[model samples]
Target: MRTMSITNARALIIMPAWNEEIAVPDTIREVMKYAPDCDLLVVDDGSTDSTRAVAMQAGARVLSLPFNLGVGGAMRAGFRYADRLGYRAAIQVDSDGQHDPRDIAKVLDGLDAADICIGARFAERGSYKVTGPRKWAMQFLAFVISRLAKVRLTDVTSGFRAANQRAIRQYLDHYPAEYLGDTVDSLVVAIRSGCRVTQVPVEMRVRQGGVPSNNPFKSGIYLARSGLALLLALTRKRSVLTKLEG
Candidate 1:
């Protein structure tokens, strides 16, 4: 595995939020509670609610967008911010609070051996379970991406992930805004760019608030769209990070 020392690296927790007024505050608070030293930035992805104000009130730096961009766009903005401010590492946390705040440090620690570390739900660490097409689709993507990345990755679509400086630069250059692009295609891009990837088993929790987005109907669509996204990522031109600035 690629090695790096994050012993003194400045880390940023990037929470991409859209219309998560109810959950964002508690999530931010929990992050502060667990990882108090890390800087927290909430990217309000054109939230139609008071996400921006509430996040700021909850003691996080808020980056507001004019319109709703999906998680991909919000994350792109977050990475750019991290790059500008010289954060050595960044971890993506859901504002809806499914990701456990206590695991933030574990995910960041993954940067010690890999450019990107994913907090995997199905890595035999948690009781997280998925049924039907979603489960099948996740398995297929994990298998394909593991081959491409040359690593045993059990959860390629996991949003709870961390990136070191190298991976952050790669993300800034190629992070996509398409459906499933943030998770699946983005990882493929990083792998193609010569970034090392790995995963840490993490438990998935029920959302503290907001309606769950996944359903039986959406699972079928996710299966199809995720496959297409992976195909496009594989066929897309490779962006080799020859000499990136830290």
Candidate 2:
């Protein structure tokens, strides 16, 4: 396994929260306990709740968006922040508390030689309950993404991921805007850019509160849109010439 150089200790953890006031503090606190050396940033995506205040109280730098941007927009904003601050690496953790902050070290370890490291929940056996349709949809999407990007990823939509400076800069430059389609856009971008991407086993939990934003119907639509987008992205010949050109 490739290990991160000691000099690259300046890592930042960014959590994009949307009305997750009740859970943000605990997530931040857990993350701090797990990765104290890493800085934390909470991107409040136009949350009307006390997300910002709670994040601040947890000692995290908070960035409030004037309007509600979906997950992709919020993540794009966080990437920009990481780039601007010159952080060596940035790890994205969801604020819903489904993603365990304790597995952050696993992500960090995977990033030693990779430009991007994604937490693959499928690699481990877990008790986390997922809706039947959603689970099937995710599996299908992962298969499609793997074929298009030519990378065998176990979990394509997993939000828990770590990226290096190069990955952050690339996302800031070419992140997709419309129908972000979960995190497929970011994963495809990283793959096409030839960024070294790795996946490690990580345990995930079911959300503690709040309804899942993506219902079965919404998930179907998202899958269709994402498939179209991926086809277009793969066929279009831009700067990313090969799967690992960079």
Q: Top lDDT: which candidate number? A: 1
Q: Where is model 2 poorest over a 10-residue stretch in terms of lDDT?
A: 237-246
Candidate 2 lDDT over residue span 26-77, tens digit each: 8888888877778899999999989999889988899999988888888889
Error of 1 at 179 (Å): 0.5
On a 0 to 1 TM-score scale, where does candidate 2 land against the true structure?
A: 0.86
lDDT to native, each model: 0.90, 0.78
For candidate 1, list the clashing residue pairs, or say none. Answer: none
After superposing candidate 2 on the true structure, give the runs of residues whose Cα lies further than 4 Å from its correct spot: 1-8, 129-133, 148-151, 214-216, 235-246
Candidate 1 lDDT by residue in tens digits, 126-238: 79998999999999999999999888999999999999888888898899999998999999989988999989989899998889878999999989998999999987666
Which residue segments of model 1 deviate by more than 4 Å?
Answer: 1-5, 243-246
TM-score, candidate number 1: 0.95
